[model samples]
Target: MKRIVCLLLFCALSSALPVYSLTFAPAEETAAAVADFERGQQLFHSGSKERALATLRTSVQRDPGHPKANQAYTLIGRIFIEQKRYPDALLYLERIPAVMRSPEADLLRGYCLVQTGDFAGGQAQLLPLLGQSFSVQDTELLLLALTDAAVNLQQPLNALFFIQKALPLAENQASLLERAHRLLQGHLSDIELEEAAFMWQGTAIGQDARLQLARRALGQQQQQKATHLLQMVLASDVTFPYWQEAEMLLQRSSMDSWFNRDSIGVLLPLSGRYASYGELVKRGLELAVREHNRTRLPVRLVYRDTAVEGVSTSQLVSSLTDDAKVMAIVGPLLGAGAEEAATRAQLEMVPLISLSQRAGLPQRGDFVFRDSLTAEQQIQSLVRYAIDTQHISFSVLRPENRLGEEMTRLFVDEVRRFGGEIVDIVSYPEEGTDFRKQIQSLLWEDYVVDIPPKPELPEFDEFGLPIEKKEEDKKEPEELEYPLAPFHALFMPDYAERISVIAPQLKFYGIKDVTLLGINGWNAPELVERAGRFLDQAVFVDGFFSASSQPEVQRFVELYRQAYEEEPTILSAQAFDAANMLLLGMDDATVRNRDDLRQRLAALRGFRGVSGTVGFDAMGEAIKQPYLLGVKRRRIVEIN
Candidate 1:
């Protein structure tokens, strides 16, 4: 069997077909606008495109934000696209607000752009839709458009991506087959042809691809391979229109093969030094699988423990891949383990979502996803909130360590991005308890040298000799007046243990009025118990907070407590959310494949889970909007 080489996303867009878009119910606007839009839609459906366009225009003029207006614009734009009126279609489509526009509208717009020979812009719009749709029809349609654009752009491999996905979810198999035949006869080369053939291996299109491969084999004088491929094609369902053709080729001579498409691997350190952490992750996976049990897909969970004293991360993953026949892997929490698994997974083309926070982990490849929160996220969250609250100037009190330095850089970048200033950065020894010097330096900045005081001139006696000021005769000078600290916000992106001590010390040193900014580490209860009064109104961002009153979050905390007999740790929350996302994506068998899983992860948006809102960036790194919480009455409270 030919391996589906996913060398480029561009190759996935190898052909074009009718794409679908999303639609929403019209908001209650002026009855007239609604009526006009409804009428326009009816007319359009009734074969009066021109009348419908007029009515839609009238409706939009009355209330552009109305659902009716969006629907009308969508219809009008799509009609113009079908008519090859690219400019008109774009004009109509652009009127609908992005938030209100449907996937269908976006797809149609892309189609129109492509039709006008704007292939790049067309693909730009269409590519993002890969795993977003809740509807298979929408997905198929979008894939079709991508395939056509890719083929036209001479990226036949891109066509393979679209067709393979389009094949499995094809409600309109006839349409896909027709497109495939056209692509095979025209743009596809031997390699591209092989890629497409393997994508649809069991489906009807697979048979077509097989037939082509066989013919190519015959042309190449490889009679045995030709007969084998032909036999495979003939073995496909007779419902396919070309079954007879397959038989004719098969009778010449051949061979065959089959594959099992069930099982995913869960690799965790279940019985070693990292057992506790692995257990938390495992619970999350178990919960996710239990929840997904309702779907009843044939896929099974194959669990492997990478924790055996002698078992290396590579060995553990290899066992699952070679022996277990797993489709994807979720695993090993430690950075070293995650890196090993990532390298192996990337090399093998297996999808792996590592719940490790190692910097540059996901950079290993497209197949490796770092679902854990990163240092950048922690610092960026603190900086963003500080800026949003109009805190223009900031100070940093970080530990003298690599983490502190890393966070400091990230904070500085974010501050500049959002137009804020860094007043001072003071780093104390990581293990130091007394930060008096750092705090003093942050405030006073070596005042003896930086702000030298002028010597007092005493009154001279009758003689010209310099007279020393007597204790009884001279007046005493008042206390020195210190300048106010330059910054209004102080960022400390370290753990609560050190932060708790540092925060109180800052107050003792009179670093008042500056908002105390921290990352998830400060979300600990110790921060509240030890420094709550000091940090009142102080905000810290976190990926998960059990204290959140959000109903879903509350439910998760409760369930976690009941299941684990303790409060859910950040590890549990993050792992649960990550696993949940994978489970949800796995609902579609067609999308459960390693490559498909990665694509689906990128397409996830605003996925609300125990670990706050979870999404993935284009690079497959976690994109979470950290919850900014404040200390109030000795309790952590959501800071809006």
Candidate 2:
């Protein structure tokens, strides 16, 4: 009923609503009214609007349509609006030319239109008034008018736009955001979030918008995007109320709910047997954080040594998992350590980006991801090269260990897939030194002994007469030469210690000219010292080659050497790339929690990284391209 009455009143009086900003007569035409106009302006400025209105009436009567009269009409219209005399205000305001309309008068007429329920019309009237200067009270009223029109018209997003503008001016930002969130929850599109980011850029609200956007990226498993979005949070003031959580998300970048945590766990064997390896990875982590902390990004790094105080790997990982403040975990170089942390990470739904690889470590859940090379990937590359080189028959020789067993499966799959055959597959104990027995079984070790001696035959002279055979030589049995094994190549997935013994034994056993293929474990330069000339022409695949001449690779090597005074090994290179990958990938994924970061890392493909092209296979493990290295004259050279 009240609404009906308001509607009737709107129909009766709305026609008189202002079409403001009309052109007025020039000041020369207002000369006759100058005295009254001056008095009216003085009275208005002195807070005597009632006296000013009477004086302004005299000015308009003397010089009709004068600019001074238009100003008088605007003041009178505003007065009538305050007094709730809507039709009277609109009658005075309508005479004003559009060009002559003051911001104050437009707001007043816009308010009248909305109060009378002509929301769209009122919004249209105020649209032009935006981007104009107004007092605090006037700005608040204008915002209220925009909000009302937007809500009544069912344009919620438009209302949000106005609310965002007023957020900085609001008395309680949290309350405003809470209310706004209810209205906006699922209505905002990705593009709208981005637009809000731009609209609120350089303000706290902008950061919040970016956080929202980062959540989307992380949800899609785009790590770098998340990192980029959260980087801004780190660059902000640590004193911010949300700084601790932002820092946590930046460090680990778990989820939006987890973004408020402030610490990230770095679990490495920093104090004991693997300290050197830990140092290499730590250097990469430091460099990554140093480059990003120019803005004092709020994340706090908590380094936990896996070998600390005799703590076991599982114990350390479990303790970190229990640390409510630790939002993400990014270490544990040992495969066992990563595996130990994997289950707890999944259960907690936190993210764990391990720098080591173990079967089923990250495969069980989206909570864990690896950026380190594995035996499967290394063996796949080596087998592919062997097949490509036309070596159709291959002998697989490896240590009797888990890695060897796993690598054997991968090698056999690829070799047979490419129309090749596994001529022989042999395994020796990892601690074995004498592999002659093993090599002999695969080669021509017994070929000389297998055949009985034959009589030496006489050579014929040029004259066609048979020359006499030497009596002693004819009685002596002829020694026979043996051909190598039936296989054209050998795929050895063992490291230098074992390969050195095995490689030479194969050659000593009369196996020559056989293509020798190896996995990343053969990349150590010491293999030349151990295997000596036997390593010649041997080709192997490796996760990283510090000596690579790629511009990016060269720069990393120089920087790493300069910073640490040592040549970087594959471990250091992979660790560096891992750290850098997390940092850069997060930018693309934006700032979410660690679980989202795990997904992002898993979804990565062909991301050009320092270690290799960092990507993930279907099982959520690193699909890094290992370099094919050939030993030529005891020197390492990259093979195509």
Best by lDDT: 1
TM-score, model 2 to reference: 0.54
TM-score of each model, paired residue for residue: 0.57, 0.54
- For model 2, the superposed segments whose C-alpha errors exceed 4 Å read 1-257, 260-264, 294-300, 308-327, 401-403, 444-479, 588-599
The lDDT of each candidate is 0.73, 0.70
Across 1-640, the per-residue lDDT of candidate 2 in tens digits comes to 9999999998776565442213355666568677788898899889897888788778877776564667777877776566555656777777776656778888888887876678998999998888889987688678878877886786766877787777767777776564454333233567887887787676655666676566556545566897898887668652233444345445554433434345567788887788988888888777656665666444556788887775676566557755544666787888766776775565444566788866767654555667777777777787777777788888887789987888888887666545577778888887988887788777745554555545556689999898986767555455655565779888887887677777777777777888888877777768887776897768888778877777878888887778778887776777666666566545543646554465566667767777775676544567677888988778788877
For every candidate in turn, the CA RMSD to the true structure comes to 20.6, 32.3
Per-residue lDDT for 310 in model 1?
74
Error of 1 at 520 (Å): 1.6
